[model samples]
Target: MRLALFQMTSGIDAASNGDAIAAAMDVAADGGADALLTPEMSLLLDRDRERAAVRAEADYPEIAVLRKNARELNLWLHLGLPVKQGDKRRNRTLVIAPNGEIAARYDKIHLFDVDLATGESWRESRVYEGGDAPVLVEMDEQEVGLSICYDIRFPALYRTLAEAGAGLLTIPAAFTVPTGRAHWHVLARARAIETGCFVAAPAQVGRHEDGRETFGHSVVIDPWGRTLLDMEQGRGVGFADIDFAAVARARVQVPALANARPIPSPVRRGMAAQAN
Candidate 1:
């Protein structure tokens, strides 16, 4: 399948963001893309809690447009992360089928709560509630697993998805500049190598309306951990051709997933005493 990953800067206006998304989807479809993927907070990116809450009400207009575009263009789409309306919002990703129906939804499982030496502090949990379960979907005979930004730090989740027959993993993010510089590429490559799954990461780049900056190097990696496409700070669509056969080849060569074993807990390993 041909996938187009969009790396764009989204701001506070949901309507404006939706317009941009529509334009991107149109371009992707014209480029012979079977599917189009976007970054986190595709609808709106803002740090002002009060404004965000007020702007992102329960009526998600952006998702509606996405579904319509998917059906009209007969193309699959992954709306990376949108704020779902609730008393407390949920950071959610939606997989839309060509028929404009939602195939799967995965809420972000890990909240980004960190304090950086650059004097940047983020408390995602303050506004968004984390999801409790992982999500996997089958698209055109390919099993795809879903995740968000902060979840990349947790390898077990990727392992579980791969074990469940996911050959492709999607991690859409709006990563901070510091963390992205320090760990983005390495972490993404590690996830692909460890799981033997194709990694497609569409990310946000540049400055947002809230005066927040994101590191944008959206990448697509093969199952063997080879870079297929990398959007390095460019603000546009990045395309990559996906081969299902490559996934099988990599898994067969390594066979790491099949040779898995159970390990003792920290307590059994005598690490519990160290904590005390």
Candidate 2:
């Protein structure tokens, strides 16, 4: 499958971000991409809660426009956006098929709540509710796992998806520069290697209207931990060709998933006396 990853520098303006995403879809379609994956918060990235809520509430209109575009272009679009759910919002991904139907929706199960050494702090749980389950969907004859930015840190989720027959994983993110530089590539590659699944991480890059900087290396890693495409610091769409055969080969060569066995609870043992 041919995939296009959109590395965006989304800002406080919802309309502007929507326009950018729509334009990228056109580019991806014209380039003969089977699907376009966008970064997290592709619709609006704002630190201010009040402003963000107002802007995010208006997302349905933008989604309608995007759906129309998807239908017209006959392109599949996997978009990351903030969705208003009852009294709170959820960081969600919507996979729209070529026919403009919503094929799948996955809310982010992990929230980023950290106090960084760089004096940057984020409390994602403050405004968003966490999802309860992992989502796997069929697309282009392959099973795809859905996850968002902070979800990459949790290996259990990836393992569950992999065990559930997912051959491809999508990790769309808006990562802080500090964490991104330290763990982004390592975590992505680790998940791919562990699960024997192709990893596609479309990321948000550069300074935003909200005064935060993000690490911008949107990457795609093969099951063997090979970096297929890395759009380092550039803000646009990057393309990669995925071979499902690689997934099969990697799994067969490693056989870790097949060899996996449940571990029993640890039993405490008395410590032996140390020799003087």
Candidate 3:
């Protein structure tokens, strides 16, 4: 499958972000891409709770436009946005099929609550409710696993999806500059190598209207942990070809999934001697 990763610098305006995403979808379609993956908070990236809440409606107009465009273009889309559910909000990823239907919805399971030494602090949990389960959906005969930004730091989530027969993993993010510079590439490649699956990460780049800067290295990694495409620090679409056969080849070579075994509780040192 041909994939397009859109690196965006989304701002506080939902309408502007919507326009950018729509334009990128057109470019992806023209480039013959089967799917387009966009960064997290593709609609709006406002740190202000009051401003963000105003646009976080369940029936967002931007989403309707995106769905209609997806149907017209006959291309799949992986979009990340903040969604309102009753009195709560969720950082969500929606996998939209070519027929303008939602194939799968994955709320971001891992919320980013960090205080970096570089004086950058984020408390994602303050505004969003974490998702309880992982999501895997089928697209063009391929099973794709869905995850948001902070979920990349957790390996067990990726393993669960891989064990459940996911061949491609999509990680849409708006990573901070400090953390992105340190662990972005390594963690992404690690997840791909560990699961023997293709990893496509579309990220937000540059400074935003909300006064936050993001690291903008949108990357695609094969099962063999090779960087197929990297759009480093830019706001545009990057294309890559995904070969499922490579997944089979890598899994066969390593056999990590097959060889996985359940772990038992560790025995205490003194208790071990007594038991013996």
Q: What TM-score fits each model? A: 0.94, 0.95, 0.96
Model 2 per-residue lDDT tens digits across residues 182-241: 999999999999999999999999999989999989999999999999999999999999
CA deviation > 4 Å runs, candidate 1:
53-58, 266-276
| Deviation of model 2 at 38, angstroms | 0.3
Candidate 3 lDDT tens digits, 1-276: 999999999988788898999999999999999999999988888888877644454568888999999999999999888888667788888899999999899999988888888777788777778999999999999999999989999999999999999999999999988889999999999999999999999999999988999999999999999999999997799999999999999999998999999989986688777888
In the predicted model 3, the residue pairs found to clash are none
Of models 1 and 3, which has the larger TM-score?
A: 3
Per-candidate alpha-carbon RMSD to the true structure: 2.3, 2.5, 2.0
The better-scoring model by lDDT among 1 and 3 is 3
lDDT of 3: 0.92
Stretches of candidate 3 off by over 4 Å are 53-57, 270-276
Ranking by lDDT: 3, 2, 1
The lowest-lDDT stretch of 10 consecutive residues in candidate 3 is 50-59
- The Cα error of candidate 2 at residue 261, in Å, is 0.5
